[model samples]
Target chain A: MTGSEGPGHQVQAIGNDEDVVRVRQLVRTAAVAAKLSLVDQTKVVTAASELARNTLVYGGGGEAAVSTVDNGVRRGVRVVFSDSGPGIADIDLALTDGYTSGGGLGLGLSGARRLVDEFELDTVVGAGTTVAVVKWAR
Target chain B: MERVPILKIGSVLLVSIQVDMQDQMALQLQEDLGQRIVDTGCRGVIIDITGLDIVDSFVGRTLSTIASISRVLDAETIVVGMRPAVAITLVELGLSLDGIRTALNVERGLELLARNAEPDTFDDLDLLGDPETTSP
Candidate 1:
């Protein structure tokens, strides 16, 4: 689903590093059109980029969606990153600082969560992982 | 996607780039810089990132790696030119690049690098001579 052609106000892209970049760009563009301040726009875009990367690197690929929220009083973007890779073994440890599974410094998941106003993670060890992040204009 | 050179001033090496550094490119650049630090026998390295408008977690982590590797190699590492917005986003994202050094510009980074360098080598190098010093 494209951002422009939706009742859900959604935009979805395959999980890949490049696709993550695209998603950030889309979020930035939409945030701008929604009249978000430059500061708020960058926050949402950067957060989206981090989550998208996690979806690609850990999830073994997934999809990302962006849309407006809160009746336009504030614009919110939600990204649902799903991956089929080995799921996070320790949720708490993974969220801790300096904890890293891959070569990363373990910032993607935790950092993305911090940047957004709402954050949720649902994962099953062998099944897959899904992360949802939403940020509202302040 | 251009390969930039690592600048050397005395015992310090400086590398600066203006691009949307992300994913593998960021990692590759960090690795290459680490190798250069070892090869050059520099005492410190400074990465001037003034022109970067955005930094993803991958790039942030790669930079942290560069700093860590620099220390292991006995070279100091500094990240400069971090825009306020970028810094705020990074902090809010909970991405802590702790243990990494930072400066405001190449000149300040060079000075800091020089300060961290072997004192004897400080007098012999000129950082502003030419950007060509960084050419691969």
Candidate 2:
């Protein structure tokens, strides 16, 4: 739950490089608050960086939310990135490593998925794309 | 936009990244380093990232690019001071940082560069084993 007690209260805009860094800091704070291990914290922060960049470059600027989640037994840090740019036409191709439309390493989507516990992607060809990822503490 | 400073010591250039580098900042460092390598004619580069919290794909790619650029300029690049947690995360993230050499710290990095730069002093010894070798 996103409350004033934690750092994941605001939905920050991902308009430029600065915003990406801000998103990373927010995710790290939330991850630490969720009591994740140091390695897990690094993984989530790295994943957040990749996704935030994708939201800015491929998605043409968007927003991200960092929050802590609970599913009865486990507590996790969740990050949601949403963009209203040209949505991905081929999800599978985009998810493939080394495949990029913007001349990137093509690790943004695929690699981010590997670093987290749960990954979800929703996109529309002409509308937008939203990616939600969760990294749970063990 | 903050710039990462490049310090020159002897023939090696030391770059200690103390900030959380943005995408543009990373690109700026790559360009600045390329220019510094040419300006100083440095033979080796040691990049310290102990202050970096994460080495995401973007940063990893930038480091790789920097290594290539330095190599083209006849310089060696070694990435040092990587945190253990970051290394674990990078591996799970599937980025091996190809073409980039890494060390545990700056001292070892310098040692690596020194070893690589060492000249072969035993070139004449190879002739001893040749078929043209004659008894003294």
lDDT per residue, candidate 1, B8-91, as tens digits?
777678788676654656767877887887788877787888877677677777788888888888888889999888888888
Per-residue lDDT tens digits for candidate 1, residues A1-138, read: 112222355666655556776787777766766666667777878878877777777778777766665543555555567777788889998887667777676777777777777788898999888877666666
**Best candidate, TM-score:** 2
lDDT of 1 at B89: 85
> Which regions of candidate 2 deviate over 4 angstroms?
A1-7, B120-136
CAPRI grade, predicted model 1: acceptable
Clashes (N, CA, C under 3 Å) per candidate: 3, 0
lDDT of 2: 0.91
**How many angstroms is residue A95 displaced in model 2 relative to the true structure, after the best TM-score fit?**
0.9
Which whole-number lDDT from 0 to 100 does residue A50 have in model 1? 75
Candidate 1: clashing pairs of residues: A59-A83, A111-B93, B5-B134
